[model samples]
Target: MYKIVEKEHFSENVVKLIVEAPMIAQSRRPGHFVIVRIGEGGERIPLTISAADTVKGTITLVVQAIGESTRKICALEIGDCFTDIVGPLGQATHIENVGTVVCCGGGVGVAPLLPIIKAMKEAGNRVVSILAARTSDLIILEKEVSEYSDEVIIMTDDGSKGQKGLVTAGVESVINREKVDLVVAIGPAVMMKFVSLTTKKYDIPTMVSLNTIMVDGTGMCGACRVTVDGKTKFVCIDGPEFDAHKVDFDEMIMRLRAYN
Candidate 1:
């Protein structure tokens, strides 16, 4: 069992939990994720590792309680333990010195992008991060993300904090002013689709993390299959990250909206 050592409410519906999993913490890379189950008969869910403290043997998970499984996980207290905590799974982000890179994150997507941005910074790239949410209250990890970013731009749809626009607007500002080496975006499917569309116009290399529906997470279920460059790719193994320009957004959108 993975023990929950600490928990904090980042927002009304978002919770951050630290789990005592030394092995996973030490093994986890910037973009790796884990499959967790709250208890017996519970559904397996995949979440990105927001941060890891190797020395402390803990991994941080920032989760938005959006559905049944997620809500149950969010309801867990500091002392609660998970029935299953499997991985440092999937491939890690490819970090390299890509000159000026922009890491665009929206809402809970900020949690996953945080570590990637830090890794990019350490790779000797000048990192500009754009974090956004519907309102100020929905934003998370503002202070932590700022530490790693060369410049951090925050956007809120309601304009309660930072600029009054979408994260794509921030990307536009950066793209217009400077030569962007790459753009990595993670957020709602619709938001990622738009971010990819926006970056495509500038011809900058762009990647996006897809949060498709999954069950086994081991690539055996084929539930999270997505089309990239016209070929079927399983998000679990092939990538949660893929070339944004080549991904079939229309197909992905149809699949994502089927039951919703």
Candidate 2:
């Protein structure tokens, strides 16, 4: 059992938990995720490792209570335990000195993007981050993300904070002012789709993390399958990160709605 060492509410529906997972924390890289099970017979769910502390033997998970399983996980208090937590799974983000990199994150997607921003900056790239949410209340990790980023832009649909516009606008604003070597976007599938489209116009290389349906965290389930560059790839093994331009977002978006 992995104990929840700390817990904080990011918003009304979003909760952050720091869990005791020494092995995973020591080895987890940016873009890796874990499959968590609450208890016996509980549903398995995939959650990205938002941050990890080797010395503390802990990994952080940011969860938005969107459904039954996530809600259950979020409802647990500090000192509670997760019955099963499996991974450091999925491919880690490829980091290098890629000149100027823009990391775009939407809602809880910002949680996973934080580590990548820190890694990029450490790799000697000028890192710019864009954080977007439906409203001011939904925006999270601003202070944390800003610490690692050279510049931070906030976008909200409601004008409660930052600019009153979509994340795509923020992407274009940066692209127009200077050259961007790469863009890493993680958010709703639809947001990534449009971000990919926007970057494609400028011929900028972009990467996106796919949060798809899954049963087993392993590829055997065939639940996280996605089409990339016209070929089938399983998110669990092949990638949770893919070249944004080549992914078939339309199909993936439709697949995400299958249960809804």
Candidate 3:
């Protein structure tokens, strides 16, 4: 049993949990995720590792209660436990000193992007982060992300935050003002698709993290399959991160709507 040592609500629908997982805490890298089950016969859900503390033997998970399984997990209290927690899975993000890097995150995607921003800054890159949400209250981890980023831009669909625009506009604004070597985007499928389009115009190398319907958290299920450069790829083993320009977002987005 993995005990929830701490819990905090980021928004009405989003919760952050710090759980006891010493092994995962010590081994997890940026871009790694875990498959969690609430109890016996419970549905498995995959979540990206938001942060980890080896000394505390804990790993942080940020979950938005978008569905049944996620709601169950989010409803748990600090002392509650997850019946199963499996991972440090998926390929780690390739970190390099790639000059100026712009990291774009939307909604709960900001949680997973935080660690990457920190790692990019540490690797000797000038990190600029763009965080977006529907409104100010929906934005998570602004202070934490800002700590590692050289500059942080906030975008919201409504004019309730730093800039009243889409995340893509923020990315274009930065790209127009200066040279950006790499762009890392994580968010809704539509948001990522447009972000990819925007970056492709500038010919900047862009990477995106995909959240697909995953079962078994292994390649055996074939549930997380995606097309990259017109070929089949498994998100579990091959990547949760892929070259944004090469991914078939339209097909992937359709697959995601299967359950909806």
Candidate 4:
């Protein structure tokens, strides 16, 4: 059993939990994720490892209570223990000293982008980050993200906090004013799709993290298969990260809406 060591509210429905998982913490990287089960017979849910502390033997999970499994997990208190915690799963982001990287995040997607931003900075890249949400209250990791980014841009759909617009607008402004060497985005599939469309116009090198449906994170389950460049790839094993230009966004959107 993995004990919950800490919990912090990110929003009314979103919470961050730090769980005691030494081995995973020691090995998890920028893009690795964890599969968590709250108790016996509980459904397994995948969560990105937002942060890790090897010395403390803990991994940070930013969970949004959107579904039954996640709701159960987020309901857990500090002293509670999980039945299972599996992973350091998925390929780690390849960090390079790429000149200027514009990292984009929408809503809870910002949490997953945290480690990547820090890694980019450590690799000596100037990061211009964009954090977008429907309203100011939904934005995550503003102060923490700012610490690692060279420049941080905030946008809200209703002008509740930062600029009044979508993340794509912010991306356009950055690309127009500066030469962005790399662009990385993570968000709802629709949001990422639009961001990719924007970057495609400028022919920028863009990568996106695909939060596809998954049953087993080990590639045994084919639930996370996606078509990229007309070829099938499994997100669990092949990537949660992929070249944005090549992904078939329409098919992915349809698949995501299958149950909805």
Total backbone collisions for each predicted model: 0, 0, 0, 0
Q: List the residue pairs that clash in candidate 2.
A: none
- The TM-score of predicted model 3 comes to 0.99
Q: Which lDDT value does model 1 have at 165?
A: 97
Which residue pairs clash within candidate 3? none
- Poorest lDDT segment (10 consecutive residues) of candidate 2: 212-221
TM match of model 2 to true structure: 0.99
How do the predictions measure up, each by TM-score? 0.98, 0.99, 0.99, 0.99
TM-score of 1: 0.98
Off by over 4 Å in 2: none
In the range 1-260, model 3's lDDT, one tens digit per residue, is 99999999999999999999999999999999999999799999999999999999999999999889899999999899999999989999999999999999999999989999999999999999999999999999999999999999999999799999999999999999999999999989899999999999999999999999999877998999999999999999999999999999999999999979
Clashes of 3: 0
The collision pairs in model 1 are: none
Q: Candidate 1's residue-wise lDDT over 1-260, tens digit each? A: 89999999998789999999999998899889998998789999999999999999999999898888899999999889999998988889999998999999999999999999999999999999999999999989989999999999999999999999999999999999999999999999889999999999989999999989888989999999999998999998888899999999889999989958
Query: Considering summed lDDT, which 10 consecutive residues are worst modelled in model 1?
Result: 31-40
Local accuracy of candidate 2 as per-residue lDDT tens digits, 4-34: 9999999989999999999999999999999
Clashes of 2: 0
User: For model 4, where is the 10-residue window of minimal lDDT?
Assistant: 38-47
Provide the lDDT at 190 for model 1.
89
Residue 208 lDDT (model 2) = 97
